[model samples]
Target: MTKTLQKTTALSTKNGKKSPTDKNLSARAAAAQIILQVLDHGKSLSALLPEIQPRMKPQDLPLLQEICFGVCRVLPRLEWIIRLLVDKPLKGKTRIVHCLLLVGLYQILYTRIPPHAAINEAVNAARQLKSDNFRGLLNGVLRRFLRERESVLATVDKHWQTNHPEWLVNKLKKTYPNWRDIIDANNQKPPMWLRVNRNHSSAENYRQRLAENGITAFPAENPHALRLESPVSVSQLPHFAEGWATVQDVHAQWSAILLEPQNGELILDACAAPGGKTTHILEQAPQAKVVALDVEENRLKRITENLARLNQQAVVICGDATRPETWLPQAAQQITGNKSAVKFDRILLDAPCSATGVIRRHPDIKWLRREQDIAPLVEIQHQILTALWQTLKPNGILLYATCSVLPDENGRQIARFLAEHSDAQLEPLPFPAPQAIGHQFLPAENGGDGFYYAKLRKIA
Candidate 1:
């Protein structure tokens, strides 16, 4: 079936009188499209947004975000509600019709939008998706849900404490016994945070800079970050045009600060992509020699762009963090007196994991990630950390970081690493470090995302 681009307030090329698509499509349309892509196309919403965002108007971006996010956040609930109404499941291409109904239910249940708009837009989206014939089926399912929202959702809540995948939720229960709060936290939206360019100016200085440029900010609960009072585009931010501040999670920003990378120190940012921590390292220690490495060449683009924006130079490489031999440069070997190529005064291994801690920011995780993914992630983190451990100079700091809250990933992983490597010692964190395992920042009160960090010293 041909997908129809039917939308509220306008129709597409088939019925076009003038412009094929609406010049100013409502937030619902864009959100619906992203939902379809994630549901029907099986794409990563976070990765897809950077590519899809350009066509969106700034005002509508948040709304577009809400649509994709709202559905994903409560996707399991939506699915649960969907199951209550539909007798037999729709499968394959026909399943998209089911997804479209989920969108309708999401709007009616979650958003402030009126039922008329939600119904019309969702129906039109179905029509646009070439599921017009299923429009009746979509309409019936959604309308039934709208009429029964309270009872259905109360049932969902009373019985279903979490909408997470069963295996994933079970793992969380096991790994994080006191993790209902953490699990609940990831189901909400993560705030947009900025790590102030401390080298150029203080966070207060940036706060004032932001106000001058018409951006409003609240004192970030995190020391180095400033939470936007309202989310805004980069163009509207003061000196953003001139590279004043960069978007980074408050929790992730802590790694660079904890490392305290000093001038003349050689540093390594391993598995650094979409280079938040890498840029923070450079932001804090401009004169420090840096090497940023990632396995995927495509992801290195973010490191390249971010480094360029910060006016910092790091030897950026597309190589696996697990295999430093492929990435180590000639000069780095001599700097550390190590024949194994580049050894560093300090290293930041921000290993990739299941990212369960960041679910609020990427709700797709609720569906895309499974309980089975965790052990392999631990295995990979183990390999990367073990491989990179030898590259640190004596007394070099290796900060193991993950946007994951599991004990196995953050605490146990560090514990296992310590047990295996007699040469490696879990160092006392700097003056500002949190007390939790290595440093486990929970979802609430931190006013930040869920994160884990463990600092280890290579015994210089």
Candidate 2:
């Protein structure tokens, strides 16, 4: 274990408290703790998983992820099951036990693990969590569930089938004609998509290399994208450490393609943390002078790291997109030698949103995101678009993108922007839908996550 995890475990145990990081914590117990954090404390699984995964036995890592993600994917159904099994709701300090029940129930219902093993682990996990008093209760509930599984599921099947929260389901129904399909897509586990780095190899060549390595990846509509038959660790991919490719969704690759970065042109990628698109742009136009900007200093490091891995370079800046003047002029001056002047040939605003589009990849978003959160997010996206428009040169294109399916954050947002800015002209995408101002790609079975892209050109 790393010193950080060790220290955390030490501190958590110092007060004679049974913590999630307790030395004897089983994988099931750890999974329950993570669920507790997400459901009760409103923490994100993405952030929590990393902190705990390192402490897990390597063999247990996949199980830990599966349980946590699976529990979140069908949370409502799991809660419903709990209601039928238990006399009273598990609350307060006992909420961990409720989470333990969730993990156990999810394993039995969703996974290939034998029911006995799943029940035993959860029962043992209860003891590890200092809920030994509830071990009998856990055992009884799980056993009863197995016996009445058919009847219980039959009752749940009669209810609304969309396992999503009521507010989100209602909103989706109001917006999309095919809302049921969208909800079905969200419940699935996402397929793994790879973006072949053109700097190092062609997508075809990379697919060949994967075949040689016993990995199957099929080409997608995007020339640079490949969808894997199944996800493998990055280490398993041929030349992955050498940056032959990056793991990016096929839909996401369209950002760089649509931006059409030209050689020697200046470009800006706002909110470009984790730098997937930033690196993809460099792969397309190696000589382009790019300034990758995001508000978070820590996230900016990801951009730098991705650049280094791909043997690429870009000027990365830590500044809010809502206040570009604070950093854009400095970045422009560094490249053009004019401190007062700032103009990007093209700007890519991968603005933050509700992230409803990537729910399959991040099931925790279902519970973590609230209905009231959309208006505030719309306001922020509006501010960023309004602020960043001034930095684009006349006739330059700014691609507004989001991993959101909501009209308020996607098409409607763009419609409002176009109404406000006469200088902004909405350009056409390859695939157009009537409901959206730009292209809206809904989450698909084996295709891309739900993504919205609108290209706006500044009138000269």
Candidate 3:
């Protein structure tokens, strides 16, 4: 269930006068606002961070991201601690102060920020929020937590072992026997994985280039993937402007490989925004005619930008995958000079999902996503699969992929599709899976984000 935070007025002085403008807002204050937007308003950190980061000082940018991401990562534990420290819940206009307190608690418990500095900044942030009344409360609560740190933390270990919401934890327990490992991985920071654009450079060549630039990276199981020892700015990567490589998860790189784009094949990358997998297909088979389709007009630019950087070409279109007839004929005519027939040799459906698998990469997902969201997402996936299946040529392949571990969105989804269509046959994936329908990759200690892949072939 979605919980909406009560809307409140802007910052003001204790005397009810308008306070200083946003320019004077500290990083701690800014982080508090971002956290409120996520936990209460249900906004995504990915979208909110970009809007907030540019306004912050370059040095403070990392700190801002750390506090916001860290708070979301261990939110349950922080809330648990809050209950023990504060006498009552902070509501309405005072809620931002509550978030500020969460920031202070997270810094004291998780980051290297000194307790004194963290508490001072947070109390000061409360003042910025015009909550002068809560300043002493914030100071006292943080100090109390620091004084009772060991005891408070010891109690938390017994009461709240996993930091995830109870509903999600229950779902995981039912889904995987090794549910604990999945939860552990979700709590840790995710590693950066890169996919070498084979058209521009081989993985070995890219690794050497990175080494030459003093960046250490190692090759993964995927031929073109390199896991960085430590993440660096894309600007620091050699020839990044020329798209020598891309920052993609090792699991995502498997989409193009599973599709097996052959020369002269017509491929459809449905829901292909920011075109990671679409460009991968082009890199593998440059001769293949690729149509990158997405519903979002704004995100289509990212696909074109990526294509131009890699010096690759694809027919980018903005259209609904679930209603292909509205746009498919024209796209077909452009590629095949035939308006009546619109069949693709290969299709990659990176369907919409709850994104439970990649929670570590985007911790905000844990809070923003609700258990009820899965059924609707499952229905949409079914719609796209049923619609796009018609666009696949007889004997052609369609790879159903999602960055989700839930069976309803993955293996069971495929099982239902196979049952409905006699012409559809499940083809074995390259990776191993405990399930008979599809391969599931759980977020691991130092590997790829969670992803699922089930390849299907159309019978003539």
Candidate 4:
């Protein structure tokens, strides 16, 4: 459930200009709502975006989103600055006032938006916030910010470098030891890339289609995707309606290629929702028997929509991956003609992870994920791996994957699992990258989102 911030301002009662109704809210109001919801209530940004977006105007959406994301991404720094300027921090609903200040500070510190303009609109936003009485407070804070920007930054960096949570930053320093570049890269802008379905189009053909349709193109540094000249929604791209491309980061698309599911084989894509890997599997081998399952049906509906757009098919079911009894192989075999029931040729365990890898697309990750969550996430990955390994046939391949660069969840987890499962043998990846330390894809500044994939064969 999404958490809502307590209303701090008198503005709601005073202004008909802003109301937090189901529809008809300005983008700034929506962004403010998302930011406060996440900060005060600990709701995730991904959860908030889908809820807040439907209520916003397209024109205001981008800036509003930037504010929500940017503040969260650099929140530590924003907060440090606030602490420097204000002796007593605002608390609770009144804390919304400080948070709105953060929305303003994030603009001044990081964004290309000019200082005066950011301050101007932010001060104006104060009016809508019902803190017109505090307009003087806003003006004083912003002017002090403009004059003392450099000195204030000196304080924030020593306190909040890398835009990470304090405990998380400490954990990174502990895990990575001498190097912190991975965390830094994870926080930066993520590269955009498209995977071409070999059945539908080749990279070269898609490049030509992109050029022909007036969409610019360049070959991605990654082998799996053709990078667009600039990132845009897939629907706006050329031949997207024809299913020629998908807006997946380079690391995500590689999971299917590495798994190498064959035609007519029964493959289980466990934890598959918003089904990228499931669809890509079908793209490669259209006749393959694919069963997709996620714990939540609502999440699976996104998978259904993406499948429809790609013109792909998979037997999508909603069930817990942690429980094999919940997903009956006998029933699935009847649906896909793999009635052997007890045996399956392949499984893709795209385990639920802490998601340290995809930070660029979801900056709020910096704020939401606690260091304590890592231990439990590691346990979850281990459990899912064990359950999927149980389903794999002898000599069948299993691709254990995560969109996490964390060593605990990727390499160490796999290493521990290998110790317990004697029959499982590691299958060397076809391509080796440096950060794939025993298959943990480290965050790369020059490359794709962080991902880890290890191929193992159950040799029992």
Off by over 4 Å in 2: 1-19, 22-24, 333-338, 433-436
Per-residue alpha-carbon lDDT of model 1 for 1-460, expressed as tens digits?
0000111222223443633123454565556556666765556676555555665688877777777888888887778888899998988777767767777877887889898788888777765565678878877887887788789878877874686777777777776667687777777667778888876778888898888877888776566789887778777777764567888778778889877798899898887887878888887788888888777676788888988888888878778777777667643553455545556889988888877777787777766665666788899889999999888888889988888877888888988898999889887764355555597876753367777788888864
lDDT of 3 by residue, 99-213 (tens): 9989999999899998999999999988777789889999999999989989988887775478888889999999999999999999999999899988788999999999999
What TM-score would every model get versus the actual structure? 0.86, 0.94, 0.93, 0.89
Give the higher-lDDT candidate: 1 or 3.
3
Q: What are the lDDT scores of the predictions, listed in order?
A: 0.74, 0.87, 0.87, 0.74
lDDT of 2 by residue, 77-113 (tens): 9999899889999999999889989999999989899
lDDT of model 3 at residue 391?
92
lDDT agreement of model 4 with the native: 0.74
For model 3 the local lDDT of residue 204 reads: 95
Residue pairs with backbone overlap in model 4? 11-130
Error of 3 at 162 (Å): 1.0
Worst-scoring 10-residue span by lDDT in model 3? 1-10
Off by over 4 Å in 1: 1-42, 51-62, 175-177, 212-214, 220-222, 330-340, 430-437
Model 4 / residue 259 / CA error / Å: 0.5
Backbone atom clashes (below 3 Å) for every candidate? 9, 0, 0, 1
Give the TM-score ranking, best first: 2, 3, 4, 1
Which segments of candidate 4 are over 4 A away from where they belong? 1-23, 112-114, 154-160, 329-342, 433-437
